[model samples]
Target chain A: MEQGQTMRGADAVIKVLAAHGTTTVFGYPGGAIMPIYDALYGSEVDHLLSRHEQGAAFAALGYARASGKTGVCFATSGPGATNLVTSLADALLDSIPVVAITGQVASAVVGTDAFQEIDVLGMSLAVTKHSFMVRSIDELVPTLYKAFEVAASGRPGPVLVDIPKDIQLAEMQYQTPLQALETPVVETISNLEQAKQLIRASKAPILYVGGGVGMAGAVEQLRDFAKQTGMPSVATLKGLGAMDKENPLYLGLLGMHGSKAGNLAVQASDLLLVVGARFDDRVTGRLDSFASKAKVVHLDIDAAELGKLRAPDVAITEDLREVLPALSMTLDIEPWKAEVAALKAEHEFNYNHPGSLVFAPRMLRTLADKLPEDSVVSCDVGQHQMWVAQHMWFRRPEDHLSSSGLGTMGFGLPSGIGAQVARPDAKVVVVSGDGSIMMNIQELTTIKRRKLPVKILLLDNQKLGMVKQWQHLFFEERFSETDLSDNPDFVTLASAFDIPGKQISTAEEVEPALDEMLNSEGPYFLHVAIDDAFNVWPLVPPGASNSDMIETLEKE
Target chain B: MMIHALELELHQRPEVLERILRVARHRGFKIIKMNMRSTSDVDATMELEVDSERTVDLLSNQLTKLVDVTQCRVLSSTQTAQTASL
Candidate 1:
């Protein structure tokens, strides 16, 4: 057989991936996976050589999250595949699309002790959305195709495809899948009569939107539903950018460190129409008190979340893509829109007013204004992260990426790199807290090495701000071990990595600092110092109802 | 076929690693790959894999005084297995 005509398994894998527009792959080469890497030499797909297998997985995660595409990562078996477990689990929990392919031991050495051998399939079962072990080399193309389809569709998450070493070397003819991949449809319980009854009976109706709204690509439907129902909608951190923040109905993010107006609106609401969001702890401060007066109706794709927490009065376990359209058709909410406008006139989420200084919230809100439409914002997990979710509004789908599930601290920088790589034309911004940035500060080298055009805004409070807030509120003011005044300057550190860095303190410097970083031609960092003693307000004491949020220390 | 508990503390430097393996070498032991942690940080934990049971006894008498190891012991994995059998 001619080398060019014969469809080798390695080349077939690339072709299948390329068909899905998987132009980029993150991986490291190893002895066991030499055949795949060797075949990749002539392919057009851009393969990023990651420093480690775990980094590759995380980078893939970042890419998928930013682009809403199935991210791919390749690794050799044994230790290489094992290293991907943590990142895989992270992606799985967050519903991020990741497809991990690992080259396993040779077919002859199956179940026998061989060099660089591992049971990759058995190890990844608990973490992945789906997993497969390829024995027949002929099945590789179909399996890879299936993996991408499963990963990208319906509650997207990481999937694993473990192929033995011999499978890569084996030749096969490429036969394209006959039909489009069919994903299982989750049905919504559209109790139209009940929905009408709930809408009619309620005095104050509010929409609690979540991350699934973006995943469903139902923003327009949600906007129309909001216009019809006249409900002031609040998004969870995961659902931050699903609706326009400037919209009158949009009430910003609801959770701990959430907007004061959003938190209060939920407390006052009589009917909560939750769309595509689980009532996570951050959203439901005091779980019992969350939307205390409201008759809750939750619409979600995952059935497990329907009655999970803050149990919904009418749970619709279906995609918001389908449910929102139904809501718009079943009822006319024009009169309710006036009532929602009336409610908005009474309550506001944006804490900023004229002459207000550039506080973290205002800074984020300004950045949101500065960001081009469809710009993706990735944030590290902290008080700053919550502020971004609440205050930094987004205008496009999947425009906001954060490790909401794992709540990993040092996720912003590398994730920003991944996001930028995924969509180089779309501007990427990473809003990271000082404490969170230090966890994987070494990744600064990775960003510099790639010369990715990513903008990083470091919120410098010089404290583990979240922990200290809890300490002040619950631990009798004893802020044990969560302060950071002694650490080296991050701006100075950024310079060492050859990335241009700036330090800004006053409000006068913030805009100029932002302008400088934005125009710096490549990767840049802006560090802004705010007061360490500043506490994130509207905190609900653990185990308290969400409505029972203790606003400021004086409220106690 | 007796299950033994083995504990190997990987050193940062290769020469230090060479020096530390003497205790294992003098007593004669082979490690199993499945039950070990090899970190990218260069320091990791290793289990005996096969016959991890008498590993502590072999290292305890002459090796405790060997100058660099901070701590070594018969960990709870051995005890847990024994309890499981009972």
Candidate 2:
């Protein structure tokens, strides 16, 4: 620590990020952020310039999802900062750890509506875990460190820091990383014995796993807890990879598109061991009717989420990593396990369409079987996202990343690039809908330039499939603005980017096309044209409870 | 619903009050009355009356986690703390 040393605020931003062990950042540079880019020129940290600020933000989200680290992004003021709003909201809802840095207008013209001036801090307050608008150069160092801490701490989510231009240019005595601030620790509760007692007393207990298990790095503990208690476990959409798909104790995804067994098990449970999951409306369906038979023991890191939805018989606020193992030490519920097994055997997810048409779910299952064990799949929202969730076999939660909470379109491509960059050794795949692919199609240039070996599987049905299905079921098929019949040939579009691609329109072509894409060297795209009339089954219609989901289309 | 009053002492940084207000709003509490007086160049004391269906402890615990907040406590409440009935 040199006593007389001084550095520009922009340089300090880079230094602080490096000190926090951030190796790469996904972002775009603009007028206000130029000073920071200049500081980044010769730095060891990698700056990946994305095609758009939205892409940069989603890519950082992908990086965070793939590698359990805080993702970083930077953008200039006004439009650049505004572009990141959707990403921030996406991260906030899904609980992804991201730190977004935006350069604001100089302090003098902050409220004068100067060129490229918008209040980034004011706009981002509701969407971020925490936000800081640095008013002085002296506050920069502490604010930077605080931003990282808040983003990565308990119940992780995005945090934003808006640095005005004056602060970036002002030179000040640089300070080292501040003494580690008090991160929110889920206070170690003394209710473990009470929770264990309730578990031991219950006959039909089900372990409900959520995204918090993955965020806490407690995948193994979750599995062990379920096994030791002999309780069947079900996962929310974001909690998909927390348990092995093939594990007998685990049921497939549970929510709007949850499996029959998964939903039925919840209905029959007498005790619900809810771990690391907030019971969202999608999962709960009709709030009043959800898990009506069960007494819940809710465990979460955030106290706010504990009793927000369903009242718990015992609410323990602690990390799942600590809570799961502690409570599972001596539970023996063979009878509950037997009941869960019976339900699983009777109501397992089945894909018997009785036709040769290339069904999206079956195709996804086939692709899942061929993918490498450590492969990462980033999916865009719509029917394809639900199909992948219902079919894909993830060994761990990190293997699958998607905008689960926000359900944002166009998240797959940039997210794939970020995932590939984060884990070079692992295979990366992007599953996107035709509509979603067009949203951020320019990211193909980024993939080509970086030479990332990302496989893009575009499920093209010539329509916004999910919206069309909803219209058919709820609006008497008066589909409005859901048609995309005039879409360009996807393979030709990929070719223009100098990326090799192939299109499959039949069931027979599915396996070979997937194999070709997976085996190919650098970035490859596969356009699979499937039936536009297809609908995701087991849909819980609007206002219907999870238990009342329509298992067959005829019921709708 | 009950009325709860909180007295907070905190470092006077940007968004300090906004952050506290945000938490108050999130906990389904309406700020009925507020009074702020500076304690020092960098510190300030705030008194707030919140209308809430939730308990005072829930609001106080979340407020304690804020970075700028040095201290927060429940000054008074209209109702006695209730035990979990379920």
State the weakest 10-residue window (summed lDDT) of model 1 chain A. Answer: A348-357
Clash list (residue pairs), candidate 1: A228-A333, A230-A337, A286-A544, A286-A545, A286-A546, A289-A545, B4-B52, B4-B53, B5-B52, B5-B53
Runs of candidate 2 exceeding 4 Å displacement: A1-5, A181-188, A330-332, A554-556, B1-4, B22-29, B51-66, B69-86
Q: Model 2, range A1-556, lDDT digits (tens) per residue? A: 4433688899889988888888899899998888999999999899888999999999999999999989999999999999999999999999999999999988989999999999888788778888899988888999888888889887899999999988999998887854755556556656888998888888888888889899989999988876666778889988999987668968888889988888888988889988888898888899888889899999888876767778889988776777887898555667767877888898866766666668888889988899887799999999999999998889888889988888899899998888999999888999999999999999998887788899999999999999999898989989999999999989999999889999888887878888999999998999998888778878888788777878777532
Instruction: Put down candidate 2 lDDT per residue, B1-86, tens digits, no spaces.
Output: 68889999998876788888888998778888999877888999999998777777778877886767899988888963653232
The estimated TM-scores of all candidates read: 0.79, 0.93
Error of 2 at A300 (Å): 0.7
Output the number of the DockQ-best candidate. Answer: 2
Candidate 1 lDDT, A1-556, residue by residue in tens: 1224466778777887788899789888887788889888978888877767877887798898888888999999899999888788888778888999998888899789788888787677557776777878768888888898778776788989888888888988777765574556646446755876786777778889888888888888888787766667888777777777667767676777665667777788788988888788867876777777889887877755667566677877566766776766334455655665665676545555344244777777778878877578888988888778766677765788888877887777767777888998878888999898887677777777788878889998889989887887789989899988886788889889888888887776777778787767888888898876556666767786665656667432
What is the lDDT, from 0 to 100, of the residue A118 in candidate 1? 81
Per-prediction backbone clash count = 10, 0
**Model 1 misplaced regions, further than 4 Å:** A1-5, A107-118, A180-190, A317-319, A329-358, A477-481, A554-556, B1-86
Q: After aligning candidate 2 to the native by TM-score, how far in Å is the CA of A132 from where it should be?
A: 1.1
